[model samples]
Target: MNDISAQAATLQWNDQGLVPAIAQDWQTGEVLMLAWMNREALELTVREGRAIYWSRSRGALWRKGEESGNVQHLKELRIDCDADTVLMKVEQVGDIACHTGRRSCFYQRLENGEWQVTDPVLKDPQTLYGKS
Candidate 1:
Protein backbone atom coordinates (compact mmCIF):
# COMPACT_ATOMS: atom_id res chain seq x y z
CA MET A 1 0.00 0.00 0.00
CA ASN A 2 1.21 3.47 -0.82
CA ASP A 3 1.78 5.85 2.00
CA ILE A 4 -0.49 8.85 1.74
CA SER A 5 -1.24 11.85 3.83
CA ALA A 6 -3.99 11.44 6.39
CA GLN A 7 -5.76 14.53 5.17
CA ALA A 8 -6.28 13.22 1.62
CA ALA A 9 -5.64 9.53 1.99
CA THR A 10 -9.23 8.85 1.02
CA LEU A 11 -8.87 10.53 -2.34
CA GLN A 12 -8.57 8.31 -5.39
CA TRP A 13 -5.13 9.08 -6.69
CA ASN A 14 -3.81 8.05 -10.05
CA ASP A 15 -0.88 5.75 -10.61
CA GLN A 16 1.52 8.65 -10.27
CA GLY A 17 0.02 9.57 -6.94
CA LEU A 18 -1.59 12.58 -8.45
CA VAL A 19 -5.13 13.81 -8.99
CA PRO A 20 -6.35 16.33 -11.50
CA ALA A 21 -7.20 19.71 -9.98
CA ILE A 22 -9.30 22.29 -11.73
CA ALA A 23 -9.36 25.92 -10.66
CA GLN A 24 -12.46 27.97 -11.32
CA ASP A 25 -13.38 31.57 -10.79
CA TRP A 26 -15.59 31.68 -7.72
CA GLN A 27 -17.74 34.55 -8.81
CA THR A 28 -18.04 33.87 -12.54
CA GLY A 29 -17.78 30.08 -12.57
CA GLU A 30 -15.00 30.25 -15.14
CA VAL A 31 -12.46 27.48 -15.18
CA LEU A 32 -9.01 28.97 -15.03
CA MET A 33 -6.65 26.06 -15.39
CA LEU A 34 -6.23 22.37 -14.80
CA ALA A 35 -3.25 21.21 -12.78
CA TRP A 36 -2.10 18.16 -10.92
CA MET A 37 -2.02 17.62 -7.19
CA ASN A 38 -0.26 15.14 -5.00
CA ARG A 39 -0.96 14.34 -1.38
CA GLU A 40 1.29 17.06 -0.05
CA ALA A 41 0.05 19.65 -2.49
CA LEU A 42 -3.57 18.88 -1.75
CA GLU A 43 -2.95 19.02 1.96
CA LEU A 44 -1.09 22.29 1.70
CA THR A 45 -3.84 23.81 -0.41
CA VAL A 46 -6.45 22.83 2.10
CA ARG A 47 -4.40 23.91 5.06
CA GLU A 48 -3.38 27.25 3.60
CA GLY A 49 -6.65 27.91 1.83
CA ARG A 50 -4.75 28.55 -1.37
CA ALA A 51 -4.08 26.67 -4.56
CA ILE A 52 -0.94 24.59 -4.37
CA TYR A 53 -0.17 22.05 -7.07
CA TRP A 54 2.43 19.51 -7.99
CA SER A 55 4.43 20.67 -10.91
CA ARG A 56 5.24 17.66 -13.04
CA SER A 57 7.65 19.67 -15.10
CA ARG A 58 9.51 21.00 -12.10
CA GLY A 59 9.00 17.82 -10.12
CA ALA A 60 8.08 19.82 -7.02
CA LEU A 61 5.25 21.47 -5.19
CA TRP A 62 4.32 24.83 -6.67
CA ARG A 63 2.21 27.36 -4.89
CA LYS A 64 0.01 29.06 -7.45
CA GLY A 65 1.24 32.59 -8.19
CA GLU A 66 4.47 31.98 -6.37
CA GLU A 67 6.29 33.73 -9.15
CA SER A 68 3.56 35.99 -10.39
CA GLY A 69 1.15 38.02 -8.32
CA ASN A 70 -1.89 36.16 -9.60
CA VAL A 71 -2.69 33.91 -6.69
CA GLN A 72 -5.80 31.79 -6.49
CA HIS A 73 -7.37 32.18 -3.08
CA LEU A 74 -9.33 29.01 -2.47
CA LYS A 75 -12.96 29.55 -1.65
CA GLU A 76 -14.20 26.00 -1.85
CA LEU A 77 -12.85 22.60 -2.74
CA ARG A 78 -14.99 19.76 -4.07
CA ILE A 79 -14.37 16.27 -5.33
CA ASP A 80 -15.89 14.53 -8.25
CA CYS A 81 -18.11 11.44 -8.17
CA ASP A 82 -15.12 9.14 -8.67
CA ALA A 83 -12.95 11.23 -6.36
CA ASP A 84 -10.37 11.48 -9.12
CA THR A 85 -10.70 15.17 -9.84
CA VAL A 86 -10.74 18.18 -7.52
CA LEU A 87 -12.67 21.32 -8.36
CA MET A 88 -11.60 24.51 -6.64
CA LYS A 89 -13.65 27.64 -6.44
CA VAL A 90 -11.15 30.44 -6.02
CA GLU A 91 -10.92 34.18 -6.07
CA GLN A 92 -8.28 34.70 -8.73
CA VAL A 93 -6.11 37.60 -7.68
CA GLY A 94 -4.55 39.89 -10.33
CA ASP A 95 -7.36 38.90 -12.71
CA ILE A 96 -4.97 36.85 -14.80
CA ALA A 97 -4.85 33.09 -14.76
CA CYS A 98 -3.11 32.08 -17.95
CA HIS A 99 0.66 32.13 -18.24
CA THR A 100 0.35 33.83 -21.58
CA GLY A 101 -1.16 36.87 -19.84
CA ARG A 102 -4.75 35.94 -20.54
CA ARG A 103 -7.64 35.78 -18.10
CA SER A 104 -7.89 32.02 -18.33
CA CYS A 105 -5.86 29.17 -19.72
CA PHE A 106 -8.93 28.04 -21.64
CA TYR A 107 -8.75 30.90 -24.06
CA GLN A 108 -8.72 28.74 -27.13
CA ARG A 109 -11.85 27.67 -28.93
CA LEU A 110 -12.43 25.09 -31.60
CA GLU A 111 -13.95 26.92 -34.48
CA ASN A 112 -14.62 24.78 -37.54
CA GLY A 113 -12.40 22.13 -36.06
CA GLU A 114 -9.50 24.53 -35.81
CA TRP A 115 -8.15 25.91 -32.60
CA GLN A 116 -8.51 29.65 -32.41
CA VAL A 117 -7.30 32.04 -29.75
CA THR A 118 -10.29 33.82 -28.28
CA ASP A 119 -8.78 35.79 -25.44
CA PRO A 120 -6.48 38.76 -25.50
CA VAL A 121 -3.39 39.17 -23.43
CA LEU A 122 -4.13 41.51 -20.58
CA LYS A 123 -0.48 41.92 -19.61
CA ASP A 124 2.65 41.16 -21.53
CA PRO A 125 4.56 38.12 -20.36
CA GLN A 126 7.81 40.03 -20.31
CA THR A 127 6.34 42.47 -17.83
CA LEU A 128 4.58 39.88 -15.71
CA TYR A 129 7.39 37.36 -15.43
CA GLY A 130 10.22 39.85 -15.86
CA LYS A 131 11.43 37.77 -18.80
CA SER A 132 10.88 37.31 -22.50
Candidate 2:
Protein backbone atom coordinates (compact mmCIF):
# COMPACT_ATOMS: atom_id res chain seq x y z
CA MET A 1 0.00 0.00 0.00
CA ASN A 2 1.03 3.57 -0.58
CA ASP A 3 2.04 5.84 2.27
CA ILE A 4 -1.29 7.64 2.40
CA SER A 5 -3.32 4.45 2.26
CA ALA A 6 -1.03 2.83 4.78
CA GLN A 7 -1.56 5.70 7.18
CA ALA A 8 -5.31 5.48 6.81
CA ALA A 9 -5.28 1.76 7.51
CA THR A 10 -3.77 2.34 10.95
CA LEU A 11 -6.69 4.44 12.15
CA GLN A 12 -9.42 2.82 14.27
CA TRP A 13 -12.63 3.74 12.54
CA ASN A 14 -16.02 3.32 14.08
CA ASP A 15 -18.66 1.00 12.71
CA GLN A 16 -19.72 3.80 10.40
CA GLY A 17 -16.22 3.81 8.95
CA LEU A 18 -15.55 7.25 10.32
CA VAL A 19 -13.07 8.78 12.69
CA PRO A 20 -13.28 12.10 14.55
CA ALA A 21 -10.79 14.63 13.27
CA ILE A 22 -9.92 17.81 15.08
CA ALA A 23 -8.49 20.87 13.35
CA GLN A 24 -6.33 23.26 15.31
CA ASP A 25 -4.42 26.43 14.53
CA TRP A 26 -0.89 25.57 13.53
CA GLN A 27 0.71 28.57 15.19
CA THR A 28 -1.63 29.42 18.04
CA GLY A 29 -2.65 25.90 19.08
CA GLU A 30 -6.27 26.93 19.13
CA VAL A 31 -8.72 24.21 18.22
CA LEU A 32 -10.74 25.32 15.23
CA MET A 33 -13.21 22.57 14.62
CA LEU A 34 -14.09 18.90 14.86
CA ALA A 35 -15.30 16.86 11.94
CA TRP A 36 -15.49 13.32 10.68
CA MET A 37 -13.38 11.56 8.08
CA ASN A 38 -13.68 8.39 6.14
CA ARG A 39 -10.65 6.56 4.82
CA GLU A 40 -10.88 8.33 1.47
CA ALA A 41 -11.10 11.70 3.16
CA LEU A 42 -8.06 10.95 5.27
CA GLU A 43 -6.04 9.86 2.25
CA LEU A 44 -7.12 12.89 0.27
CA THR A 45 -6.15 15.19 3.10
CA VAL A 46 -2.70 13.62 3.40
CA ARG A 47 -2.13 13.74 -0.37
CA GLU A 48 -3.53 17.21 -0.89
CA GLY A 49 -2.05 18.72 2.27
CA ARG A 50 -5.37 20.24 3.19
CA ALA A 51 -8.33 19.58 5.46
CA ILE A 52 -11.10 17.50 3.98
CA TYR A 53 -13.94 15.91 5.95
CA TRP A 54 -16.89 13.66 5.43
CA SER A 55 -20.13 15.60 5.87
CA ARG A 56 -22.71 13.50 7.59
CA SER A 57 -25.44 15.95 6.74
CA ARG A 58 -24.44 16.37 3.12
CA GLY A 59 -23.36 12.78 2.69
CA ALA A 60 -20.23 13.79 0.78
CA LEU A 61 -16.74 15.09 1.07
CA TRP A 62 -16.49 18.65 2.39
CA ARG A 63 -13.30 20.41 1.50
CA LYS A 64 -12.42 23.17 3.93
CA GLY A 65 -12.89 26.62 2.47
CA GLU A 66 -14.09 25.13 -0.81
CA GLU A 67 -16.84 27.76 -0.84
CA SER A 68 -15.80 30.31 1.78
CA GLY A 69 -12.20 30.94 0.77
CA ASN A 70 -11.04 29.87 4.24
CA VAL A 71 -8.95 26.86 3.38
CA GLN A 72 -6.90 25.10 6.03
CA HIS A 73 -3.36 24.33 4.94
CA LEU A 74 -2.16 21.29 6.81
CA LYS A 75 1.02 21.64 8.82
CA GLU A 76 1.00 18.36 10.71
CA LEU A 77 -1.25 15.41 11.47
CA ARG A 78 -1.18 13.30 14.63
CA ILE A 79 -3.18 10.35 15.82
CA ASP A 80 -4.12 9.61 19.40
CA CYS A 81 -2.65 6.67 21.31
CA ASP A 82 -5.80 4.69 20.67
CA ALA A 83 -5.55 5.56 16.97
CA ASP A 84 -9.16 6.63 16.99
CA THR A 85 -8.88 10.42 16.74
CA VAL A 86 -6.95 12.65 14.38
CA LEU A 87 -5.48 16.00 15.23
CA MET A 88 -4.56 18.30 12.36
CA LYS A 89 -2.48 21.40 12.86
CA VAL A 90 -3.11 23.77 10.02
CA GLU A 91 -2.77 27.33 8.83
CA GLN A 92 -6.31 28.56 8.59
CA VAL A 93 -6.78 30.92 5.68
CA GLY A 94 -9.13 33.89 5.87
CA ASP A 95 -9.03 33.46 9.68
CA ILE A 96 -12.33 31.67 9.75
CA ALA A 97 -13.01 27.97 10.30
CA CYS A 98 -16.62 27.86 11.40
CA HIS A 99 -19.54 27.98 8.99
CA THR A 100 -21.02 30.53 11.38
CA GLY A 101 -18.22 32.86 10.24
CA ARG A 102 -16.39 32.52 13.54
CA ARG A 103 -12.74 31.55 13.94
CA SER A 104 -13.82 28.30 15.53
CA CYS A 105 -16.84 26.08 15.84
CA PHE A 106 -16.41 26.17 19.59
CA TYR A 107 -17.90 29.60 20.12
CA GLN A 108 -19.90 28.82 23.21
CA ARG A 109 -18.62 28.79 26.75
CA LEU A 110 -20.49 27.78 29.82
CA GLU A 111 -20.68 30.54 32.35
CA ASN A 112 -22.30 30.35 35.76
CA GLY A 113 -25.19 28.46 34.25
CA GLU A 114 -25.87 29.14 30.60
CA TRP A 115 -23.79 28.89 27.45
CA GLN A 116 -22.43 32.17 26.22
CA VAL A 117 -21.13 33.23 22.87
CA THR A 118 -17.44 33.90 23.25
CA ASP A 119 -15.96 34.50 19.83
CA PRO A 120 -17.19 37.20 17.53
CA VAL A 121 -18.03 36.38 13.97
CA LEU A 122 -15.16 37.41 11.77
CA LYS A 123 -17.36 37.54 8.69
CA ASP A 124 -21.03 37.47 8.06
CA PRO A 125 -22.28 33.98 7.28
CA GLN A 126 -24.57 35.31 4.58
CA THR A 127 -21.61 36.78 2.75
CA LEU A 128 -19.46 33.73 3.20
CA TYR A 129 -22.10 31.27 2.03
CA GLY A 130 -23.95 33.69 -0.24
CA LYS A 131 -27.14 33.00 1.58
CA SER A 132 -30.26 35.06 1.15
Candidate 3:
Protein backbone atom coordinates (compact mmCIF):
# COMPACT_ATOMS: atom_id res chain seq x y z
CA MET A 1 0.00 0.00 0.00
CA ASN A 2 1.16 3.50 -0.75
CA ASP A 3 1.93 5.71 2.18
CA ILE A 4 -1.20 7.77 2.76
CA SER A 5 0.48 10.50 4.74
CA ALA A 6 3.22 10.92 2.14
CA GLN A 7 0.71 11.06 -0.67
CA ALA A 8 -1.44 13.63 1.08
CA ALA A 9 1.53 15.80 1.91
CA THR A 10 2.65 15.84 -1.72
CA LEU A 11 -0.56 17.27 -3.14
CA GLN A 12 -0.96 20.96 -3.89
CA TRP A 13 -4.64 21.70 -3.65
CA ASN A 14 -5.81 25.14 -4.65
CA ASP A 15 -7.16 27.89 -2.35
CA GLN A 16 -10.51 26.14 -2.37
CA GLY A 17 -8.73 22.98 -1.31
CA LEU A 18 -9.37 21.30 -4.61
CA VAL A 19 -7.20 19.73 -7.26
CA PRO A 20 -7.82 18.98 -10.93
CA ALA A 21 -8.24 15.35 -11.80
CA ILE A 22 -8.20 13.76 -15.22
CA ALA A 23 -9.72 10.33 -15.69
CA GLN A 24 -8.49 7.97 -18.40
CA ASP A 25 -9.08 4.46 -19.62
CA TRP A 26 -6.44 2.15 -18.29
CA GLN A 27 -6.33 -0.27 -21.20
CA THR A 28 -6.87 2.16 -24.08
CA GLY A 29 -5.23 5.17 -22.44
CA GLU A 30 -8.07 7.32 -23.69
CA VAL A 31 -8.80 10.42 -21.68
CA LEU A 32 -12.38 10.11 -20.45
CA MET A 33 -13.13 13.24 -18.46
CA LEU A 34 -11.89 16.04 -16.28
CA ALA A 35 -13.14 16.90 -12.82
CA TRP A 36 -12.19 18.52 -9.57
CA MET A 37 -11.35 16.63 -6.39
CA ASN A 38 -10.96 17.76 -2.85
CA ARG A 39 -9.06 15.83 -0.17
CA GLU A 40 -12.13 13.83 0.80
CA ALA A 41 -12.82 12.83 -2.77
CA LEU A 42 -9.25 11.80 -3.34
CA GLU A 43 -9.15 9.78 -0.19
CA LEU A 44 -12.47 8.11 -0.94
CA THR A 45 -11.36 7.28 -4.47
CA VAL A 46 -8.20 5.62 -3.23
CA ARG A 47 -9.91 3.80 -0.42
CA GLU A 48 -12.90 2.58 -2.38
CA GLY A 49 -11.22 1.85 -5.69
CA ARG A 50 -13.73 4.00 -7.50
CA ALA A 51 -13.64 7.42 -9.12
CA ILE A 52 -14.89 10.21 -6.88
CA TYR A 53 -14.99 13.87 -7.83
CA TRP A 54 -15.88 17.06 -6.03
CA SER A 55 -18.99 18.61 -7.50
CA ARG A 56 -18.55 22.35 -7.59
CA SER A 57 -22.16 23.08 -8.43
CA ARG A 58 -23.52 20.71 -5.82
CA GLY A 59 -20.87 21.51 -3.27
CA ALA A 60 -20.36 17.82 -2.48
CA LEU A 61 -18.31 14.81 -3.36
CA TRP A 62 -19.78 12.64 -6.10
CA ARG A 63 -19.20 8.96 -6.43
CA LYS A 64 -19.42 8.11 -10.14
CA GLY A 65 -21.49 4.95 -9.95
CA GLU A 66 -23.79 5.99 -7.16
CA GLU A 67 -26.69 6.98 -9.36
CA SER A 68 -26.09 5.97 -12.97
CA GLY A 69 -24.27 2.71 -12.28
CA ASN A 70 -21.73 3.85 -14.84
CA VAL A 71 -18.73 3.29 -12.70
CA GLN A 72 -15.04 4.04 -13.05
CA HIS A 73 -12.94 1.49 -11.22
CA LEU A 74 -9.58 2.80 -10.14
CA LYS A 75 -6.58 1.20 -11.81
CA GLU A 76 -3.89 3.68 -10.94
CA LEU A 77 -3.44 7.19 -9.63
CA ARG A 78 -0.66 9.47 -10.77
CA ILE A 79 0.31 12.96 -9.80
CA ASP A 80 2.28 15.47 -11.82
CA CYS A 81 5.63 16.74 -10.54
CA ASP A 82 3.96 19.78 -9.07
CA ALA A 83 1.15 17.67 -7.57
CA ASP A 84 -1.39 20.25 -8.62
CA THR A 85 -3.04 17.87 -11.05
CA VAL A 86 -3.75 14.15 -11.01
CA LEU A 87 -4.30 11.49 -13.65
CA MET A 88 -6.56 8.62 -12.70
CA LYS A 89 -6.39 5.44 -14.73
CA VAL A 90 -9.75 3.70 -14.50
CA GLU A 91 -11.73 0.84 -15.92
CA GLN A 92 -14.98 2.43 -17.02
CA VAL A 93 -18.27 0.61 -17.05
CA GLY A 94 -21.14 1.34 -19.43
CA ASP A 95 -21.06 2.79 -22.94
CA ILE A 96 -20.80 6.42 -21.96
CA ALA A 97 -19.13 8.56 -19.35
CA CYS A 98 -20.02 12.03 -20.55
CA HIS A 99 -23.06 14.04 -19.54
CA THR A 100 -23.67 14.54 -23.27
CA GLY A 101 -23.97 10.74 -23.54
CA ARG A 102 -20.64 10.45 -25.33
CA ARG A 103 -17.89 8.02 -24.41
CA SER A 104 -15.63 10.90 -23.50
CA CYS A 105 -15.98 14.53 -22.54
CA PHE A 106 -13.46 15.60 -25.18
CA TYR A 107 -15.82 14.88 -28.03
CA GLN A 108 -15.12 18.01 -30.03
CA ARG A 109 -12.08 18.84 -32.10
CA LEU A 110 -10.59 21.38 -34.46
CA GLU A 111 -10.51 19.86 -37.90
CA ASN A 112 -9.79 21.49 -41.26
CA GLY A 113 -9.51 24.81 -39.40
CA GLU A 114 -13.04 24.47 -38.18
CA TRP A 115 -14.52 23.47 -34.85
CA GLN A 116 -16.10 20.10 -35.48
CA VAL A 117 -17.80 17.36 -33.60
CA THR A 118 -15.42 14.43 -33.32
CA ASP A 119 -17.35 11.89 -31.27
CA PRO A 120 -20.93 10.93 -31.77
CA VAL A 121 -23.02 10.16 -28.72
CA LEU A 122 -22.92 6.52 -27.75
CA LYS A 123 -26.16 6.81 -25.83
CA ASP A 124 -29.03 9.24 -25.59
CA PRO A 125 -28.65 11.92 -22.95
CA GLN A 126 -32.37 12.29 -22.37
CA THR A 127 -32.57 8.69 -21.21
CA LEU A 128 -29.72 9.24 -18.82
CA TYR A 129 -30.11 12.75 -17.43
CA GLY A 130 -33.81 13.04 -18.27
CA LYS A 131 -35.27 15.89 -20.28
CA SER A 132 -34.85 19.19 -18.49
What are the per-residue Cα lDDT tens digits for candidate 1 across 3-95? 225648788999999999999999999999999999999888888888999999999999989888899998988889988899999999997
Residues 45-86, candidate 3, lDDT per residue (tens digit)? 888899999999999999986666789999999999898998
- For model 3, give the RMSD to the true fold: 1.8
RMSD to native for every prediction? Answer: 3.5, 1.5, 1.8
Clash counts per candidate, in order, are: 0, 0, 0
Q: Rank the candidates by lDDT, best first.
A: 2, 1, 3
lDDT of each: 0.90, 0.93, 0.88
| Candidate 3 clashes between residue pairs 3 or more apart in a chain or in different chains | none
TM-score of each: 0.93, 0.96, 0.91
User: For model 2, how many clashes?
Assistant: 0
Q: After superposition, how far is residue 126 of candidate 2 from its true place, in Å?
A: 1.2
Report the lDDT tens digits of candidate 2 across residue range 28-114: 999999999999999889889999999999999999999998999889999999999999999998889999999999999999999
In angstroms, give how far residue 78 of model 2 lies from its true place. 0.3
- Model 2, which residues run further than 4 Å from truth? none
**Which RMSD does model 2 reach against the true structure?**
1.5
TM-score for candidate 2, please give it. Answer: 0.96
